[model samples]
Target: MKKNIYYFDNSATTWPKPECVLNNLKYFLNEIGGSPGRSGHRMSIAASRLIEETRETVGKFFNYDDTSRIIFTKNITESLNICIFSLLKAGDHVITTNSEHNSVMRPLRFLEKKGLKITIVKCNRFGELDIHDIKNSIVKNTKMVILTHASNVIGTILPIEEIANLTFKKNIPFVIDCAQTAGSVPIGINLGKYKNCIIAFTGHKAMLGPTGTGGLCIGKDVSLKPLVFGGTGSKSDEDTQPNFLPDSLESGTMNVLGLAALKASVNYLLKMGVDKIREHEKNLITRFIEEASKIKRIELYGTKEAEKQASLISFNLKNLSPSAAGLILDKKYSIMCRIGLHCNPNAHKVIGTFPNGTIRFSFSYFNNLKQIDYAIEKIKEISRIE
Candidate 1:
């Protein structure tokens, strides 16, 4: 008999995507094959229409009125890089949290070398940020404030709405990396109230879409220079890049097939409702925490409360390295999860798990209580041997 693989790495990328997404991926490839916004042919027009429909769907999902403000990228990393590279200039100060993923860290580090001042506001060991510390870090020349919506390593959900409000009042552009919280948590997209905010999202993770589907929702007041310049299907009469919302930023052949998959996935979420998804994941987290807390020698990280976190947990055995434990879970128990720094060494350092990271079990809505029980039992068994 084939071993049943129990996947618990939804924070990295969700597995077993919605049937609609898979069907559309095939439909786009087989029936509606064409490059979006590249030509005026029938196939191209169909592709363009599909892209626009997806944009509208995304805009509605985020509660943003302007559909054109939604710009697609390969992933949240690319979306963040575009915002970081376009907004900051020489001698500008930017504020961020220490718990940020490398997607936010690497680009800021690259900019810091070129006369950009960076302030890393410290989060608690639980990965919770203090809003006052963020406010205190802001200065006269603060160009932007970029932060992650949730810690991908420890699953702590940061207070991004409060941060966005603060940055809006300060006239500083707030860029939120929502790779971990987009489809799992509620992202306030009140563009009228918070005009200087951008929410960057990846579709593959909680959105239940394929890879290469991600984008940013830009506010009206924020202006960003194009990171890439090429054909935008519009304003072809001039060689200059079009000075518009999405056309100015998106300048290449788009991933129409992937977007079709994303559209279907987002539609599924919309129909099912994000609130329901959040409730289900919270129940799973609650169960995992309750069960794992009973086992001796199992050390868990972050705020031990499920309400204060996303749907994930990070922990370590008393004597086992995260790598070794991950191997045991995979080979011996047929369990799958993420290990190591989770691309955020800074998060590990903050959580006091640096050098050797913790094993992360990130759950999705599809995961059931039985899986959590089995995982806890296996973890208990591992803890006993080690």
Candidate 2:
């Protein structure tokens, strides 16, 4: 409705968190401004309680059997590092997809140079990875399999359950980077079913929380060595990190404020129901894709249909570069989107738009059909330009 500003970049980071989120952050800053699990005071205890509540809410979201398995990290990137660098050793083989963000790919590549073997399965131009491809990639020495839950640029949702089943049978520790799909899509992963799994989630994206809020859900089979060893309020006497679910992984002072905000966001989502949120986002996708399809010169990426795609879309103009499209959207159309590689060069490569990449328009429950309408109108104009 505003003159020149519509935020359509929820896939990268969601905007306008719920009122509860803001209130919780404000409360944390005002009242519970203490280092959680560190200081032995009422303020610290309150902070710790907020953090635990967030973990419990997130654990239920993923159907985790134990809330304690949820370990806080700065973001999914940090969670990936904790899972990757902690679990994999010198001669281990790891399976992944081409549709991964550099967060996962970068660490894996670094380990690859350190003599860890890596097998990269290529998704099709639409960013669809095959379960058979993953099954074939499993080697005897394979220790872990890491892949992104959804393609950040293209919004292609992977069949984690199918792949998870295969890996579960093979007894491989599966680490999933749920940067785009967590809290946005249905994650009915029964942690009991998968013997080995670690799902890394960020609160800044579809979770609709503030930045610097994220964590990793350590599954049954993945016994990760601690990434950073430090003092936990629970085990202050021990020189080493505590041999527990969260206290082992979490080090230093925790992000109490961010966690408090995330707790409110997660509580709001749970109350609203994930199914309803998915429905809202899916509706936006359907309308947006239909309108974009009618526009000439609009080169859509990922799965062709809206139903096949997640709540995001990536595309480019016939004669415009991604950055140019982004600029036009910002200055003229008032739409905010991500351009260029979208932090996943391999995802861009999979879509045959490597190097330059495409403009990514991802949405969440906050976005409405009317906003999608405005976006469609502006996109039609931009796509037609020479």
Candidate 3:
């Protein structure tokens, strides 16, 4: 008998998107196909309407009143790059956390070479940050404070709401890297009130959208220079780019097909409810951790408190390299997971897994208790081997 395959690597990208997303993707390609805002034709108008509707849906989902402030990009990485490059200039000091993914680290590193000052606040071994460290690091010249809503490796949820309030009080811009938490965790942002906060999100993960779909919700007080330049379908009569919310940052052709799928996925998530999905995944993680704790030689990371973390867990078996165990899980047990640094070397360092990272099992709403039990049993078996 062939063994069934179990997927546990949701932090990389969500698997098995909702049927509505797939159906709409097909429908857009088949029926409504046109470049949005380019022409007055019926097909073009329909496509444009779909894009606007998606923008509004995303805005509503994030509690942002102005849908025009939402700007789409290929992924969260691009969104972060646009924000980083556009907001910070030479000699500007920026604050970030040590647990940030390379999407934020790499850009900040590049900017450091360009005469930008960066302060990387340290997080504890459990991936929890001290709010005081962030506060003390803020100097008069601090241009912005960028942080991840949750650590991708260990899955520790940060106190973004408090940090946002801190930045707002300090009169600094707060940018949140919500690549891992968006659609999975509630981002308490009242866009109408908080004009200094920005939320960057990717659609392929918890949003259950296509890979190429992601965007950023710009606050009212924030403005970013265009990372790319081209035709925005509007203001074609003039040579300069349009001075507007989305069009200023968004140029060239939009990802109509991907956005269509994203719109459908967002609608499904709205109907299903994010809190319900979060609770289900939390149960899976809690169950996994409780069972895995009983196994000898299993060293887990993070706060170990399910409510304090997201749906992911990272740990190692005794005398087992994560890479080797990952291979065993894939080839022998047919369990898929992520191992190694997960693109956040700083997070690994904080957890004392610098060179060799830990095995990561990230759960999703679709995962069941049976799958978690099986994975825990297999991990116990693996730990007993040596």
Any residue pairs clashing in model 2, and if so which? none
Query: lDDT of each structure?
Result: 0.91, 0.85, 0.91
> What is the number of residue pairs that collide in model 2?
0
lDDT of 3 by residue, 222-334 (tens): 98889998899888899998888788888989999999999999999888889999999889989998999999899999999999888899999876899999999999999
Clashes per model (N, Cα, C within 3 A): 0, 0, 0
Clashing pairs in 1: none
For each candidate in turn, the TM-score is: 0.98, 0.96, 0.98
In candidate 2, where is summed lDDT lowest over 10 consecutive residues?
1-10
lDDT of 1: 0.91
> What is the lDDT, from 0 to 100, of the residue 337 in candidate 2?
88
